[model samples]
Target: MPLPEDAPELSPALDPWEGLEPSGGQGSGGGRPSKPGPGLHLVATPIGNARDITLRALDVLAAADLIVCEDTRVTSRLMQIHGLHRPLMPYHDHNAAKVRPEILARLAQGAVIALVSDAGTPLVSDPGYRLVVDAVAAGIKVTTLPGASSVLAALTLAALPTDRFLFAGFLPPKSAARRETLGELAPVRATLVFLESAQRLADMLADAAAVLGPRPAAVARELTKLFEEVRRETLDSLAAHYAAAGPPKGEVVVVIGPPTEAAGASEAEIDAALQAELAHAGPSAAAAKVAAAFNLPRRQVYARAMALKAAAP
Candidate 1:
Protein backbone atom coordinates (compact mmCIF):
# COMPACT_ATOMS: atom_id res chain seq x y z
CA MET A 1 0.00 0.00 0.00
CA PRO A 2 1.26 3.42 -0.93
CA LEU A 3 1.57 5.75 1.98
CA PRO A 4 0.03 9.21 1.62
CA GLU A 5 2.45 11.70 0.01
CA ASP A 6 2.20 13.82 3.15
CA ALA A 7 2.88 10.86 5.40
CA PRO A 8 6.07 11.63 7.33
CA GLU A 9 8.98 9.94 5.57
CA LEU A 10 10.15 7.21 7.95
CA SER A 11 13.93 7.15 7.68
CA PRO A 12 16.97 5.60 9.36
CA ALA A 13 17.88 9.07 10.63
CA LEU A 14 15.01 8.64 13.08
CA ASP A 15 17.47 6.96 15.46
CA PRO A 16 17.38 8.60 18.92
CA TRP A 17 20.98 7.95 20.03
CA GLU A 18 22.63 10.14 17.38
CA GLY A 19 24.10 12.76 19.73
CA LEU A 20 23.24 12.91 23.41
CA GLU A 21 24.70 12.97 26.89
CA PRO A 22 27.14 10.12 27.47
CA SER A 23 25.62 7.32 29.57
CA GLY A 24 27.03 4.71 32.00
CA GLY A 25 29.03 6.69 34.60
CA GLN A 26 30.41 9.14 32.05
CA GLY A 27 30.36 12.43 33.94
CA SER A 28 32.26 15.78 33.94
CA GLY A 29 33.67 14.84 37.39
CA GLY A 30 34.95 11.49 35.98
CA GLY A 31 33.27 9.71 38.88
CA ARG A 32 29.89 7.92 39.09
CA PRO A 33 27.01 9.81 40.76
CA SER A 34 25.85 8.22 44.05
CA LYS A 35 22.89 6.54 42.26
CA PRO A 36 21.07 7.29 39.04
CA GLY A 37 17.42 7.71 40.37
CA PRO A 38 15.27 4.58 40.29
CA GLY A 39 13.15 4.00 37.21
CA LEU A 40 12.07 1.36 34.68
CA HIS A 41 12.78 2.25 31.05
CA LEU A 42 10.54 0.47 28.57
CA VAL A 43 12.54 0.19 25.33
CA ALA A 44 11.28 -0.70 21.85
CA THR A 45 13.40 -2.68 19.44
CA PRO A 46 13.15 -3.44 15.73
CA ILE A 47 10.66 -6.04 14.57
CA GLY A 48 12.92 -7.38 11.81
CA ASN A 49 15.48 -4.94 10.39
CA ALA A 50 18.38 -4.16 12.70
CA ARG A 51 18.56 -0.44 11.84
CA ASP A 52 15.09 0.45 13.10
CA ILE A 53 16.29 1.14 16.67
CA THR A 54 16.06 4.68 18.07
CA LEU A 55 18.92 6.84 19.46
CA ARG A 56 17.10 7.53 22.71
CA ALA A 57 16.69 3.78 23.17
CA LEU A 58 20.45 3.38 22.73
CA ASP A 59 21.09 6.12 25.30
CA VAL A 60 18.79 4.41 27.78
CA LEU A 61 20.37 1.00 27.12
CA ALA A 62 23.82 2.47 27.67
CA ALA A 63 22.84 4.46 30.76
CA ALA A 64 20.84 1.83 32.59
CA ASP A 65 22.76 -0.14 35.21
CA LEU A 66 21.19 -3.37 33.96
CA ILE A 67 18.93 -4.43 31.11
CA VAL A 68 16.17 -7.05 31.49
CA CYS A 69 14.95 -8.67 28.31
CA GLU A 70 12.87 -11.56 27.00
CA ASP A 71 15.88 -13.15 25.33
CA THR A 72 19.41 -12.17 26.41
CA ARG A 73 20.93 -13.39 23.13
CA VAL A 74 18.42 -11.44 20.99
CA THR A 75 18.87 -8.28 23.01
CA SER A 76 22.62 -8.85 23.01
CA ARG A 77 22.70 -8.81 19.22
CA LEU A 78 20.67 -5.57 19.20
CA MET A 79 22.96 -3.97 21.78
CA GLN A 80 26.03 -5.14 19.89
CA ILE A 81 24.69 -3.50 16.74
CA HIS A 82 24.34 -0.19 18.58
CA GLY A 83 27.82 -0.56 20.19
CA LEU A 84 26.19 -0.67 23.63
CA HIS A 85 27.82 -2.95 26.21
CA ARG A 86 25.45 -3.06 29.17
CA PRO A 87 24.73 -5.94 31.56
CA LEU A 88 21.81 -7.78 29.96
CA MET A 89 19.69 -10.26 31.97
CA PRO A 90 16.91 -12.58 30.87
CA TYR A 91 13.42 -11.75 32.22
CA HIS A 92 10.61 -13.71 30.62
CA ASP A 93 7.47 -15.74 31.34
CA HIS A 94 9.37 -18.76 32.65
CA ASN A 95 11.30 -16.84 35.31
CA ALA A 96 9.55 -13.48 35.62
CA ALA A 97 8.17 -14.36 39.04
CA LYS A 98 11.62 -15.11 40.42
CA VAL A 99 13.31 -12.09 38.78
CA ARG A 100 10.71 -9.43 39.60
CA PRO A 101 12.05 -8.94 43.15
CA GLU A 102 15.66 -8.66 41.98
CA ILE A 103 14.59 -6.03 39.45
CA LEU A 104 12.66 -4.22 42.19
CA ALA A 105 15.75 -4.21 44.41
CA ARG A 106 17.75 -2.56 41.63
CA LEU A 107 15.03 0.04 41.16
CA ALA A 108 14.86 0.58 44.92
CA GLN A 109 18.61 1.22 44.86
CA GLY A 110 18.03 4.08 42.40
CA ALA A 111 19.43 2.21 39.42
CA VAL A 112 17.95 2.93 36.01
CA ILE A 113 16.88 -0.39 34.47
CA ALA A 114 15.88 -0.90 30.86
CA LEU A 115 13.43 -3.60 29.70
CA VAL A 116 13.19 -4.87 26.13
CA SER A 117 11.83 -7.79 24.15
CA ASP A 118 13.39 -9.94 21.43
CA ALA A 119 11.47 -7.82 18.91
CA GLY A 120 9.17 -4.84 18.62
CA THR A 121 7.82 -2.89 21.62
CA PRO A 122 7.75 -4.52 25.01
CA LEU A 123 4.50 -5.68 26.71
CA VAL A 124 2.73 -5.94 23.36
CA SER A 125 1.53 -9.56 23.31
CA ASP A 126 4.97 -10.06 24.81
CA PRO A 127 6.06 -10.47 28.39
CA GLY A 128 6.62 -7.51 30.80
CA TYR A 129 3.02 -6.74 31.76
CA ARG A 130 3.46 -8.11 35.27
CA LEU A 131 6.67 -6.17 35.73
CA VAL A 132 4.95 -2.96 34.71
CA VAL A 133 1.96 -3.75 36.91
CA ASP A 134 4.29 -4.36 39.85
CA ALA A 135 6.33 -1.25 39.12
CA VAL A 136 3.23 0.92 39.02
CA ALA A 137 2.05 -0.55 42.31
CA ALA A 138 5.45 0.23 43.83
CA GLY A 139 5.27 3.76 42.45
CA ILE A 140 8.48 3.30 40.52
CA LYS A 141 9.24 5.78 37.77
CA VAL A 142 8.33 3.78 34.69
CA THR A 143 8.81 5.36 31.27
CA THR A 144 8.63 4.08 27.69
CA LEU A 145 10.93 4.83 24.72
CA PRO A 146 8.65 4.04 21.80
CA GLY A 147 10.03 3.00 18.45
CA ALA A 148 9.11 0.09 16.12
CA SER A 149 6.09 -2.15 16.70
CA SER A 150 4.86 -5.08 14.61
CA VAL A 151 1.23 -4.15 15.29
CA LEU A 152 1.65 -0.66 13.88
CA ALA A 153 3.77 -1.92 11.03
CA ALA A 154 1.26 -4.59 10.08
CA LEU A 155 -1.63 -2.17 10.35
CA THR A 156 0.17 0.10 7.91
CA LEU A 157 1.03 -2.79 5.65
CA ALA A 158 -2.44 -4.36 5.66
CA ALA A 159 -3.97 -1.18 4.22
CA LEU A 160 -6.92 -1.72 6.50
CA PRO A 161 -8.83 0.84 8.55
CA THR A 162 -6.29 2.12 11.05
CA ASP A 163 -8.34 4.90 12.62
CA ARG A 164 -10.08 2.24 14.70
CA PHE A 165 -8.69 -1.26 15.41
CA LEU A 166 -8.62 -3.90 18.09
CA PHE A 167 -5.47 -5.92 18.63
CA ALA A 168 -6.82 -9.34 19.63
CA GLY A 169 -3.28 -10.73 20.10
CA PHE A 170 -3.35 -14.50 19.23
CA LEU A 171 -6.52 -16.58 19.21
CA PRO A 172 -7.17 -19.66 21.33
CA PRO A 173 -5.31 -22.80 20.35
CA LYS A 174 -8.35 -25.08 20.28
CA SER A 175 -10.85 -24.80 17.44
CA ALA A 176 -13.92 -24.59 19.65
CA ALA A 177 -12.43 -21.94 21.87
CA ARG A 178 -11.13 -20.07 18.86
CA ARG A 179 -14.58 -20.09 17.27
CA GLU A 180 -16.11 -18.79 20.51
CA THR A 181 -13.55 -16.03 20.67
CA LEU A 182 -14.33 -15.03 17.10
CA GLY A 183 -18.04 -15.16 17.80
CA GLU A 184 -17.60 -12.88 20.80
CA LEU A 185 -15.67 -10.34 18.77
CA ALA A 186 -17.97 -10.50 15.72
CA PRO A 187 -19.95 -7.43 16.71
CA VAL A 188 -16.94 -5.19 17.36
CA ARG A 189 -17.11 -2.10 15.13
CA ALA A 190 -13.32 -1.73 14.92
CA THR A 191 -11.04 -3.47 12.50
CA LEU A 192 -9.75 -6.62 14.22
CA VAL A 193 -6.03 -7.37 14.32
CA PHE A 194 -4.89 -10.84 15.29
CA LEU A 195 -1.45 -12.38 15.67
CA GLU A 196 -1.47 -15.92 14.34
CA SER A 197 1.12 -18.51 13.45
CA ALA A 198 1.50 -19.33 9.77
CA GLN A 199 0.21 -22.84 10.27
CA ARG A 200 -3.05 -21.75 11.86
CA LEU A 201 -3.89 -18.91 9.49
CA ALA A 202 -6.23 -21.05 7.41
CA ASP A 203 -8.19 -22.42 10.33
CA MET A 204 -8.42 -19.02 11.99
CA LEU A 205 -9.69 -17.45 8.80
CA ALA A 206 -12.27 -20.20 8.40
CA ASP A 207 -13.47 -19.76 11.96
CA ALA A 208 -13.58 -15.97 11.52
CA ALA A 209 -15.66 -16.38 8.35
CA ALA A 210 -18.09 -18.72 10.06
CA VAL A 211 -18.50 -16.42 13.05
CA LEU A 212 -18.22 -12.99 11.43
CA GLY A 213 -19.45 -13.69 7.87
CA PRO A 214 -17.59 -12.89 4.69
CA ARG A 215 -15.90 -9.63 5.65
CA PRO A 216 -12.95 -8.11 3.81
CA ALA A 217 -9.58 -8.88 5.39
CA ALA A 218 -5.86 -8.93 4.77
CA VAL A 219 -3.14 -11.42 5.62
CA ALA A 220 0.21 -9.73 6.16
CA ARG A 221 3.50 -11.56 6.68
CA GLU A 222 7.30 -11.13 6.65
CA LEU A 223 6.67 -7.51 7.60
CA THR A 224 9.49 -4.95 7.31
CA LYS A 225 11.84 -7.55 5.89
CA LEU A 226 12.66 -8.90 2.47
CA PHE A 227 9.98 -11.01 0.74
CA GLU A 228 7.28 -9.16 2.66
CA GLU A 229 3.77 -9.84 1.38
CA VAL A 230 0.20 -8.79 2.02
CA ARG A 231 -2.74 -10.77 0.64
CA ARG A 232 -6.17 -9.16 0.68
CA GLU A 233 -9.45 -10.99 0.14
CA THR A 234 -12.83 -11.61 1.68
CA LEU A 235 -12.70 -13.82 4.79
CA ASP A 236 -14.32 -16.81 3.08
CA SER A 237 -12.20 -16.45 -0.02
CA LEU A 238 -9.05 -16.13 2.07
CA ALA A 239 -10.03 -19.20 4.02
CA ALA A 240 -10.46 -21.20 0.85
CA HIS A 241 -7.24 -19.86 -0.63
CA TYR A 242 -5.20 -20.83 2.38
CA ALA A 243 -7.06 -24.05 2.90
CA ALA A 244 -6.13 -25.13 -0.62
CA ALA A 245 -2.58 -23.71 -0.77
CA GLY A 246 -1.69 -24.30 2.88
CA PRO A 247 -0.14 -21.64 5.16
CA PRO A 248 2.67 -19.36 4.03
CA LYS A 249 5.92 -18.64 5.80
CA GLY A 250 6.83 -16.12 8.53
CA GLU A 251 4.66 -14.46 11.19
CA VAL A 252 1.15 -13.43 10.14
CA VAL A 253 -1.23 -10.66 11.15
CA VAL A 254 -4.86 -11.14 10.13
CA VAL A 255 -6.59 -7.80 9.77
CA ILE A 256 -10.37 -8.02 9.39
CA GLY A 257 -12.85 -5.38 8.38
CA PRO A 258 -15.54 -4.33 10.83
CA PRO A 259 -19.04 -5.76 10.82
CA THR A 260 -21.56 -4.28 8.39
CA GLU A 261 -24.46 -2.35 9.89
CA ALA A 262 -27.39 -4.76 10.38
CA ALA A 263 -30.82 -3.93 9.08
CA GLY A 264 -33.58 -3.85 11.69
CA ALA A 265 -35.91 -6.88 11.57
CA SER A 266 -39.35 -7.42 13.01
CA GLU A 267 -40.12 -10.76 14.76
CA ALA A 268 -42.60 -11.49 11.99
CA GLU A 269 -39.92 -10.66 9.44
CA ILE A 270 -37.41 -12.99 11.11
CA ASP A 271 -40.00 -15.77 11.27
CA ALA A 272 -40.68 -15.41 7.57
CA ALA A 273 -36.98 -15.54 6.73
CA LEU A 274 -36.54 -18.60 8.96
CA GLN A 275 -39.60 -20.34 7.45
CA ALA A 276 -38.22 -19.90 3.94
CA GLU A 277 -34.77 -21.21 4.91
CA LEU A 278 -36.27 -24.15 6.83
CA ALA A 279 -38.04 -25.47 3.73
CA HIS A 280 -34.75 -26.50 2.11
CA ALA A 281 -32.03 -26.29 4.80
CA GLY A 282 -32.29 -28.03 8.17
CA PRO A 283 -32.78 -26.14 11.44
CA SER A 284 -29.05 -25.43 11.85
CA ALA A 285 -28.62 -24.26 8.27
CA ALA A 286 -31.79 -22.21 8.47
CA ALA A 287 -30.64 -20.66 11.72
CA ALA A 288 -27.23 -19.92 10.20
CA LYS A 289 -28.83 -18.24 7.17
CA VAL A 290 -31.14 -16.11 9.28
CA ALA A 291 -28.29 -15.28 11.64
CA ALA A 292 -26.07 -14.21 8.76
CA ALA A 293 -28.90 -12.33 7.04
CA PHE A 294 -30.13 -10.42 10.07
CA ASN A 295 -26.95 -10.59 12.18
CA LEU A 296 -28.84 -12.24 15.02
CA PRO A 297 -28.17 -15.24 17.22
CA ARG A 298 -28.69 -18.62 15.55
CA ARG A 299 -29.93 -20.20 18.74
CA GLN A 300 -32.51 -17.46 19.28
CA VAL A 301 -33.73 -17.82 15.71
CA TYR A 302 -33.68 -21.61 16.05
CA ALA A 303 -35.81 -21.45 19.23
CA ARG A 304 -38.32 -19.13 17.60
CA ALA A 305 -38.52 -21.43 14.57
CA MET A 306 -39.05 -24.37 16.93
CA ALA A 307 -41.93 -22.50 18.57
CA LEU A 308 -43.36 -21.77 15.14
CA LYS A 309 -42.91 -25.43 14.19
CA ALA A 310 -44.67 -26.50 17.38
CA ALA A 311 -47.60 -24.12 16.71
CA ALA A 312 -47.96 -25.26 13.04
CA PRO A 313 -50.47 -27.99 12.08
Candidate 2:
Protein backbone atom coordinates (compact mmCIF):
# COMPACT_ATOMS: atom_id res chain seq x y z
CA MET A 1 0.00 0.00 0.00
CA PRO A 2 1.12 3.53 -0.75
CA LEU A 3 1.81 5.90 2.16
CA PRO A 4 -0.64 8.67 2.95
CA GLU A 5 -0.04 12.09 1.40
CA ASP A 6 0.75 13.61 4.81
CA ALA A 7 3.07 10.85 5.88
CA PRO A 8 6.77 11.71 6.25
CA GLU A 9 9.01 10.32 3.54
CA LEU A 10 11.26 7.51 4.68
CA SER A 11 14.94 7.29 3.73
CA PRO A 12 16.45 4.14 2.36
CA ALA A 13 17.87 1.81 5.02
CA LEU A 14 21.63 1.89 5.55
CA ASP A 15 24.02 -0.22 7.67
CA PRO A 16 24.24 1.20 11.21
CA TRP A 17 27.93 0.27 11.50
CA GLU A 18 29.04 1.26 7.99
CA GLY A 19 31.77 3.75 8.96
CA LEU A 20 33.10 2.59 12.32
CA GLU A 21 35.99 0.48 13.63
CA PRO A 22 35.16 -2.27 16.09
CA SER A 23 35.04 -0.79 19.62
CA GLY A 24 33.58 -3.96 21.14
CA GLY A 25 29.97 -2.70 21.27
CA GLN A 26 26.66 -3.42 19.59
CA GLY A 27 26.22 -3.44 15.82
CA SER A 28 29.10 -4.97 13.77
CA GLY A 29 31.22 -5.46 16.91
CA GLY A 30 31.13 -1.91 18.42
CA GLY A 31 29.07 0.82 16.79
CA ARG A 32 26.10 2.91 17.83
CA PRO A 33 22.76 1.19 17.58
CA SER A 34 19.72 2.60 15.79
CA LYS A 35 18.03 3.14 19.16
CA PRO A 36 18.54 6.19 21.36
CA GLY A 37 20.78 5.62 24.39
CA PRO A 38 19.26 5.48 27.86
CA GLY A 39 18.59 8.89 29.45
CA LEU A 40 16.09 11.76 29.29
CA HIS A 41 15.66 13.35 25.87
CA LEU A 42 14.04 16.81 25.77
CA VAL A 43 12.30 16.80 22.42
CA ALA A 44 10.89 19.82 20.62
CA THR A 45 7.62 19.29 18.84
CA PRO A 46 6.32 21.43 16.00
CA ILE A 47 4.85 24.70 17.25
CA GLY A 48 1.93 24.53 14.83
CA ASN A 49 2.58 22.63 11.62
CA ALA A 50 3.09 18.96 12.48
CA ARG A 51 5.60 18.64 9.63
CA ASP A 52 7.89 21.16 11.40
CA ILE A 53 9.38 18.43 13.58
CA THR A 54 13.07 17.58 12.98
CA LEU A 55 14.26 14.26 11.61
CA ARG A 56 16.33 13.53 14.72
CA ALA A 57 13.30 14.33 16.87
CA LEU A 58 11.37 11.67 14.96
CA ASP A 59 14.22 9.23 15.46
CA VAL A 60 14.25 9.76 19.22
CA LEU A 61 10.48 9.56 19.40
CA ALA A 62 10.54 6.32 17.42
CA ALA A 63 13.24 4.74 19.55
CA ALA A 64 12.18 6.02 22.97
CA ASP A 65 11.14 3.30 25.41
CA LEU A 66 8.51 5.74 26.64
CA ILE A 67 7.29 9.21 25.67
CA VAL A 68 6.45 11.68 28.43
CA CYS A 69 4.35 14.66 27.35
CA GLU A 70 2.08 17.43 28.58
CA ASP A 71 -1.01 15.90 27.05
CA THR A 72 -1.26 12.30 25.92
CA ARG A 73 -4.10 13.00 23.49
CA VAL A 74 -2.21 15.77 21.73
CA THR A 75 1.07 13.85 21.58
CA SER A 76 -0.84 10.79 20.38
CA ARG A 77 -2.17 12.74 17.44
CA LEU A 78 1.32 13.92 16.54
CA MET A 79 2.61 10.35 16.81
CA GLN A 80 -0.23 9.10 14.67
CA ILE A 81 0.54 11.68 12.00
CA HIS A 82 4.18 10.56 11.97
CA GLY A 83 3.32 6.84 12.03
CA LEU A 84 4.76 6.31 15.50
CA HIS A 85 3.25 4.38 18.40
CA ARG A 86 5.35 4.71 21.54
CA PRO A 87 3.94 4.27 25.04
CA LEU A 88 3.04 7.76 26.29
CA MET A 89 2.76 9.00 29.86
CA PRO A 90 1.17 12.28 30.97
CA TYR A 91 3.67 14.66 32.60
CA HIS A 92 1.94 18.02 32.84
CA ASP A 93 1.63 20.57 35.65
CA HIS A 94 -1.21 18.78 37.46
CA ASN A 95 0.44 15.34 37.53
CA ALA A 96 4.17 16.03 37.23
CA ALA A 97 4.92 15.84 40.96
CA LYS A 98 3.06 12.56 41.25
CA VAL A 99 4.55 11.00 38.11
CA ARG A 100 8.12 12.33 38.21
CA PRO A 101 9.32 9.81 40.76
CA GLU A 102 8.09 6.96 38.58
CA ILE A 103 9.81 8.44 35.53
CA LEU A 104 13.05 8.88 37.48
CA ALA A 105 12.87 5.28 38.59
CA ARG A 106 12.50 4.15 34.99
CA LEU A 107 15.41 6.35 33.95
CA ALA A 108 17.44 4.83 36.79
CA GLN A 109 16.61 1.46 35.21
CA GLY A 110 18.12 2.68 31.90
CA ALA A 111 14.94 3.47 30.03
CA VAL A 112 15.24 5.77 27.02
CA ILE A 113 12.58 8.37 27.78
CA ALA A 114 11.65 11.22 25.45
CA LEU A 115 10.16 14.36 27.06
CA VAL A 116 8.02 16.63 24.91
CA SER A 117 5.48 19.36 25.35
CA ASP A 118 2.18 19.60 23.50
CA ALA A 119 3.83 22.20 21.25
CA GLY A 120 7.24 23.82 20.87
CA THR A 121 10.32 22.92 22.94
CA PRO A 122 9.97 21.24 26.30
CA LEU A 123 10.41 23.45 29.40
CA VAL A 124 9.78 26.76 27.62
CA SER A 125 7.11 27.90 30.06
CA ASP A 126 6.24 24.23 30.54
CA PRO A 127 6.45 21.77 33.44
CA GLY A 128 9.58 20.01 32.17
CA TYR A 129 12.11 22.12 34.13
CA ARG A 130 11.56 20.35 37.43
CA LEU A 131 11.85 16.97 35.77
CA VAL A 132 15.07 18.01 33.98
CA VAL A 133 16.46 19.34 37.25
CA ASP A 134 15.60 16.16 39.10
CA ALA A 135 17.02 14.03 36.32
CA VAL A 136 20.29 15.98 36.46
CA ALA A 137 20.47 15.93 40.26
CA ALA A 138 19.99 12.18 40.20
CA GLY A 139 23.09 11.89 37.96
CA ILE A 140 21.06 10.70 34.96
CA LYS A 141 22.08 12.01 31.51
CA VAL A 142 19.84 14.74 30.13
CA THR A 143 19.94 16.11 26.56
CA THR A 144 17.79 18.06 24.13
CA LEU A 145 16.61 17.59 20.55
CA PRO A 146 15.94 21.26 19.85
CA GLY A 147 13.47 22.32 17.17
CA ALA A 148 10.46 24.59 16.60
CA SER A 149 9.74 27.34 19.16
CA SER A 150 7.04 30.01 19.02
CA VAL A 151 9.34 32.49 20.74
CA LEU A 152 11.85 32.29 17.93
CA ALA A 153 9.09 32.25 15.34
CA ALA A 154 7.53 35.43 16.66
CA LEU A 155 10.90 37.15 16.98
CA THR A 156 11.77 36.30 13.42
CA LEU A 157 8.50 37.82 12.23
CA ALA A 158 8.66 40.84 14.52
CA ALA A 159 11.34 42.66 12.42
CA LEU A 160 12.80 44.10 15.59
CA PRO A 161 16.34 44.02 16.97
CA THR A 162 17.17 40.43 17.84
CA ASP A 163 20.75 40.91 19.04
CA ARG A 164 19.56 41.61 22.61
CA PHE A 165 16.19 40.18 23.51
CA LEU A 166 14.31 38.73 26.45
CA PHE A 167 11.53 36.15 26.43
CA ALA A 168 9.21 37.03 29.29
CA GLY A 169 6.82 34.12 28.99
CA PHE A 170 3.55 35.72 30.10
CA LEU A 171 2.37 38.77 31.94
CA PRO A 172 -0.17 39.01 34.74
CA PRO A 173 -3.79 39.17 33.58
CA LYS A 174 -4.98 41.95 35.83
CA SER A 175 -4.38 45.45 34.48
CA ALA A 176 -2.67 46.93 37.56
CA ALA A 177 -0.38 43.97 38.10
CA ARG A 178 0.35 43.68 34.41
CA ARG A 179 1.16 47.38 34.19
CA GLU A 180 3.46 47.02 37.21
CA THR A 181 5.20 44.12 35.51
CA LEU A 182 5.61 46.19 32.34
CA GLY A 183 6.94 49.05 34.42
CA GLU A 184 9.55 46.75 35.91
CA LEU A 185 10.61 45.68 32.44
CA ALA A 186 10.79 49.22 31.05
CA PRO A 187 14.53 49.63 31.65
CA VAL A 188 15.57 46.55 29.71
CA ARG A 189 17.52 47.70 26.61
CA ALA A 190 16.49 44.77 24.44
CA THR A 191 13.58 43.50 22.44
CA LEU A 192 10.97 42.08 24.80
CA VAL A 193 8.98 38.99 23.90
CA PHE A 194 5.87 37.76 25.71
CA LEU A 195 3.25 35.10 25.23
CA GLU A 196 -0.29 36.25 25.97
CA SER A 197 -3.86 35.10 25.56
CA ALA A 198 -5.79 36.46 22.59
CA GLN A 199 -8.42 37.86 24.91
CA ARG A 200 -5.79 39.83 26.77
CA LEU A 201 -3.89 41.08 23.74
CA ALA A 202 -5.54 44.50 23.55
CA ASP A 203 -5.24 45.24 27.21
CA MET A 204 -1.70 43.89 27.32
CA LEU A 205 -0.68 46.05 24.39
CA ALA A 206 -2.32 49.07 25.99
CA ASP A 207 -0.44 48.48 29.21
CA ALA A 208 2.79 47.95 27.30
CA ALA A 209 2.33 51.23 25.45
CA ALA A 210 1.54 53.10 28.67
CA VAL A 211 4.67 51.79 30.35
CA LEU A 212 7.12 51.34 27.49
CA GLY A 213 6.04 54.36 25.37
CA PRO A 214 5.83 54.32 21.58
CA ARG A 215 8.42 51.62 20.89
CA PRO A 216 8.14 49.60 17.68
CA ALA A 217 6.41 46.26 18.17
CA ALA A 218 4.76 43.31 16.51
CA VAL A 219 1.93 41.02 17.55
CA ALA A 220 2.23 37.61 15.93
CA ARG A 221 -0.58 35.08 16.15
CA GLU A 222 -1.35 31.58 14.87
CA LEU A 223 2.31 31.21 14.13
CA THR A 224 3.44 28.58 11.62
CA LYS A 225 -0.21 27.71 10.89
CA LEU A 226 -2.26 28.53 7.84
CA PHE A 227 -3.61 31.71 9.38
CA GLU A 228 -0.34 32.99 10.77
CA GLU A 229 -0.27 36.84 10.90
CA VAL A 230 2.22 39.36 12.14
CA ARG A 231 1.23 43.01 12.72
CA ARG A 232 4.21 45.29 13.05
CA GLU A 233 3.55 48.81 14.36
CA THR A 234 4.45 51.24 17.09
CA LEU A 235 3.36 50.19 20.58
CA ASP A 236 0.62 52.81 20.81
CA SER A 237 -0.65 52.08 17.31
CA LEU A 238 -0.86 48.33 18.00
CA ALA A 239 -2.59 49.05 21.27
CA ALA A 240 -5.14 51.28 19.54
CA HIS A 241 -5.73 48.76 16.79
CA TYR A 242 -6.30 45.88 19.20
CA ALA A 243 -8.50 47.98 21.47
CA ALA A 244 -10.71 48.86 18.50
CA ALA A 245 -10.68 45.35 17.13
CA GLY A 246 -11.37 43.79 20.54
CA PRO A 247 -8.67 41.10 20.67
CA PRO A 248 -7.90 38.48 18.05
CA LYS A 249 -8.16 34.75 17.57
CA GLY A 250 -5.48 32.15 18.41
CA GLU A 251 -2.24 32.31 20.50
CA VAL A 252 -0.57 35.75 20.70
CA VAL A 253 3.05 36.79 21.02
CA VAL A 254 4.01 40.46 21.50
CA VAL A 255 7.51 41.61 20.59
CA ILE A 256 8.38 45.15 21.67
CA GLY A 257 11.52 46.92 20.46
CA PRO A 258 14.12 48.29 22.82
CA PRO A 259 14.11 51.82 24.16
CA THR A 260 15.14 54.60 21.80
CA GLU A 261 16.97 57.70 22.91
CA ALA A 262 14.38 60.17 24.13
CA ALA A 263 14.93 63.95 24.29
CA GLY A 264 16.74 64.46 27.60
CA ALA A 265 14.42 65.30 30.46
CA SER A 266 15.22 68.43 32.45
CA GLU A 267 15.95 68.24 36.20
CA ALA A 268 12.51 69.63 37.02
CA GLU A 269 10.80 67.11 34.78
CA ILE A 270 12.72 64.17 36.31
CA ASP A 271 12.08 65.48 39.84
CA ALA A 272 8.36 65.81 39.12
CA ALA A 273 8.14 62.28 37.74
CA LEU A 274 10.13 60.99 40.70
CA GLN A 275 7.76 62.72 43.12
CA ALA A 276 4.72 61.11 41.50
CA GLU A 277 6.25 57.63 41.68
CA LEU A 278 7.55 58.14 45.22
CA ALA A 279 4.05 58.92 46.45
CA HIS A 280 3.11 55.28 45.96
CA ALA A 281 6.53 53.57 45.90
CA GLY A 282 9.80 53.54 47.85
CA PRO A 283 12.64 55.78 46.73
CA SER A 284 14.40 52.87 45.07
CA ALA A 285 11.27 51.80 43.24
CA ALA A 286 10.45 55.40 42.31
CA ALA A 287 13.99 55.96 41.05
CA ALA A 288 13.92 52.84 38.93
CA LYS A 289 10.60 53.79 37.38
CA VAL A 290 11.69 57.34 36.60
CA ALA A 291 15.05 56.19 35.26
CA ALA A 292 13.40 53.71 32.94
CA ALA A 293 10.82 56.21 31.78
CA PHE A 294 13.43 58.85 31.07
CA ASN A 295 16.10 56.41 29.83
CA LEU A 296 18.35 57.83 32.56
CA PRO A 297 20.78 56.04 34.79
CA ARG A 298 19.23 54.40 37.89
CA ARG A 299 22.00 55.75 40.10
CA GLN A 300 21.40 59.33 38.89
CA VAL A 301 17.66 58.98 39.44
CA TYR A 302 18.18 57.33 42.82
CA ALA A 303 20.52 60.09 43.97
CA ARG A 304 17.99 62.75 42.93
CA ALA A 305 15.18 60.80 44.61
CA MET A 306 17.23 60.76 47.83
CA ALA A 307 17.80 64.50 47.56
CA LEU A 308 14.10 65.09 47.08
CA LYS A 309 13.37 62.87 50.10
CA ALA A 310 15.84 64.80 52.31
CA ALA A 311 14.50 68.18 51.22
CA ALA A 312 10.84 67.26 51.85
CA PRO A 313 9.19 68.62 55.04
Which candidate number has the best TM-score?
2
Q: Give candidate 2's whole-model lDDT.
A: 0.86
Reference-based TM-score of each model: 0.72, 0.74
Model 1 per-residue lDDT at 168:
95
| Candidate 1, residue 262: lDDT | 49
Distance from true location, Cα of 23 in model 1, Å = 13
lDDT of 1 by residue, 1-313 (tens): 4577799988976877766554334444435434445699899998888888876676678778999999999888888887889898899889999989999888877889999998989999877999999988988999998999888888766644566789999999889999999989988877899999989989999999888877767899888789888887678999999999998998788988766454755445776888888788777788788888888655455555554565458
- Candidate 2 residue runs with Cα over 4 Å from true position: 1-33, 262-313
Off by over 4 Å in 1: 1-37, 262-313
Error (Å) of candidate 1 at residue 310 is 53
Q: List the residue pairs that clash in candidate 1.
A: 15-55, 16-54, 16-55, 16-56, 17-55, 17-56
Per-residue CA lDDT of model 2 for 176-284, tens digit only, reads: 9999999999999888999999888888898998888777689999999999999877788998999898879888889987764447654457668989988899998
The TM-score of predicted model 2 comes to 0.74
